[model samples]
Target: MPTALVTGAAGFIGYHVCEQLISNGYDVVGLDAMTDYYEVSLKEARHARLESEKFTFIKGYVEERDLLMGLFETHKFDLVIHLAAQAGVRYSIDNPRSYLESNIGGTFELLEAARAYPPRHMLLASTSSAYGANTVMPYVENVRADHQMSFYAATKKATEAMAHSYAHLYDLPITMFRFFTVYGPWGRPDMALFKFTKAILEGGSIDVYNNGDMSRDFTYIGDLVSALIRLIDVLPERGSAPAGETDSLSPVAPFRVLNIGNSSPTLLMDFISAIELATERKATCNMMPMQAGDVPATWADATLLTQLVGEIPHTKVPEGVAKFVNWYRDYYKC
Candidate 1:
């Protein structure tokens, strides 16, 4: 079995991705710092659930330059999935340096490590927030993302550029996946889905940001993991460039950026309604103005992803929300 190294294997998406990889017969080495970004217990619980013979756990921060380099030297991994970062839009405003350290510096460290021991392919996590200030519906990979509202988005965008440079300079195959609003079982407490579910279940008011005018391309966790697993084998090449005739693929490096999303922009109220249906409790909406560093809507143009994987997140809101509710109720002993 090929060995895969996952940077944030204890995170919401990282846990799911690692689980899928282990199920698919990959030996996964999980690295996580167990940061108290939201709840360390949640991360621990996710890691505990992934206890398998094929899984190896390593406790460390990604920003540890020498440690990460030493790890790459020790394990010649077949693939690397970089997901550790300072996530959340609002949190970025309060702590901008965290984003710089984790997203930018951590990525630089990973690239430096990859330089010594190159993997077949690397998938780095980028967020739909990187599509900052773009009014265009269904954001595409080729879109010029020059304007970023939050420091978080800026750092993620910077990672994509940094990864591309590494890909070009060291001939490292790289894929930058820009994730949409991913939600499901093991979802982060900071995200809207988790917060709304918890608040409504406890008979509290749910904060409706932007006066409930916001939207997101809510991709289910399972479908996103399936897409990612399929993409593991479709590695880009350094010399074999993508045809430039209206193609979004990178020209200089063996690197490509893809939007791993549902290709559907869901209304904020609609998402809340799905949660309400699942929880069997109406959410008391506290209408609030749009917070700083938040966009009104995000849709993904996943044409490239569809062509590559022959699949995309098609699970409708009701179905996905119900699954999450089931997991939440069972896990929390509700």
Candidate 2:
């Protein structure tokens, strides 16, 4: 079996990716810090569900160079998926240091380890927030994202640059995926879907940001994981751009970046309505102004993702929201 090392293995997306890999007969090693950014029990519960002989769990921060180096030395990982990061746009505004430590420093540590024990391919998780203040609809990969609205996005963009340099200098095959608003079962508590579900179930009001005027290309977890698995085999090579294709392939390095999203921006109000309908409860809305480090909208141009993976995420909001609501009720017994 091919050996794969997945960082943030206990995270919402990471857990799902590990499950997918294990089910496909990969020997997976999962690393998670189990940080209290949310409920530790929730993460523990997700990890507990993946208990299997093929899956090995490690508890530690990826920024720890010694620990990462040791793991790389011990296991010859064929693929490395870096998914652990300090996530959340608003949280980065208050605690910029955590983003620096985890997003930047941790990625540096991973690059160094990969340099020593070179993997066949390295996939890093980036956020659509990296598109920052771009007003362009359906953000594409080839466009220059120089203006970041949040410290979190800035750090994620910095990692892209850092990864590019490593790929150029070491000739490492790297693919960085810019993820849109990912939501589904086992989603993060800080995310909109989770918070809204909890509030509606408990007769509490949901904070509708931007007065419910915002929009997002909410990609479901299953679709995102499927895209990721497909991308693992589509490694980039140093070459000129393909004719009439906006491939983000680097000319000097075997590196590429693609957006993995639903490509359909849904209004925030519609999203809330989906949740309300799923739970069969009316939400008391606290219409609030847009928070700091937040954009009013985000949509992805997933052309490159389709070109490479041969498919795009097609989960509609209503169906995805219903699934999340059912899982939340069953998991928490609400």
Candidate 3:
């Protein structure tokens, strides 16, 4: 069976990606460190569930050069989906070294392995936060993203550059996707939807950043995974987007950065209200100023993504929020 390597397999989106690949008849391999950055139990749960006949998992850091190199040598992967990173904007402010090790160093190691044994296509995960400090509504992919507000965004952006260089030098077919605020069932604990659900369930106050005035292009996890699957098959050639119509794709390398987001940007209060309705409870809100290194809003111009993938993320906010709340309740036995 053709093999696909998915790093951060136990992660929220990684787990979903792995499941989709396996269902589509690809032999899937997952690598995760099981870091305590959020909750180890949650990560373990995801890994345990993915333990099946066709899925093989390795528990280790991607920065481990020998392990990665060995894996690449042993299994010439048809596709490598790199999703592991030091996530969380606030966390990067406290400990930037984690970003350096996981984001920069890990990416460097992965690229080196790919250099030796090139995959048919390599999909690297980036973030919308990479479009930092830009007043541009509905952020586009072709624009210069040099001014990242957070170190987390900086590292993700840096990896995009690094991957582009590798593609240019080795002629590796690569697709870099900049994800918007992805949220849904089995979501990350650090994310707003999850936190708000937990707090509301416990009858506690939830912190609303930017004085509840912020908005985000909240991409549902299922929609994001679908786009990724479609994109894996739509590899770009050097100096072109997939169909030679979009500019977001790179001109120098077989690499392009596509935004995977629901083009609708919902207000913060509305997002909180979705969770409240889903949980059947009202949140005691604590509206506050924008935290450092955080953007007030994020909206994705997914025109290029739609053009390349021939689809757009169309999940409704209320429905997605309800799915997450149901999962949360069942998972925690609340």
Largest lDDT belongs to which candidate? 2
Backbone clashes in candidate 1 total 0
lDDT of 3 by residue, 177-209 (tens): 899999988899999999989999998999988
Q: What is the C-alpha RMSD of each candidate to the true structure, in Å?
A: 1.2, 1.0, 1.1
lDDT, model 2: 0.93
lDDT of 1 by residue, 249-309 (tens): 6678898898888898899999999999999999999999999999999999888887777
Please give the lDDT score at residue 85 for candidate 1: 93
The Cα local distance difference test for each model comes to: 0.91, 0.93, 0.91
Q: List the residue pairs that clash in candidate 1.
A: none
**TM-scores, all models, native as reference:** 0.98, 0.98, 0.98
Give the distance in Å from residue 44's predicted Cα in candidate 3 to where it truly belongs. 1.0
- Give the worst 10-residue stretch by lDDT in candidate 1: 241-250
Q: Which candidate would rank higher by lDDT, 2 or 3?
A: 2
User: Per-residue lDDT of 1-334 in model 2, one digit per residue for the tens?
Assistant: 8999999999999999999999999999999999999999999999998899999999999998688889999998999999999999999999999999999999999999999999999999999999999998889899989999999999999999999999999989999999999999999999999999998999999888889899999999999999999989888887756423688899899999989999999999999999989999999999899899899999999888887768755999999999999999999998
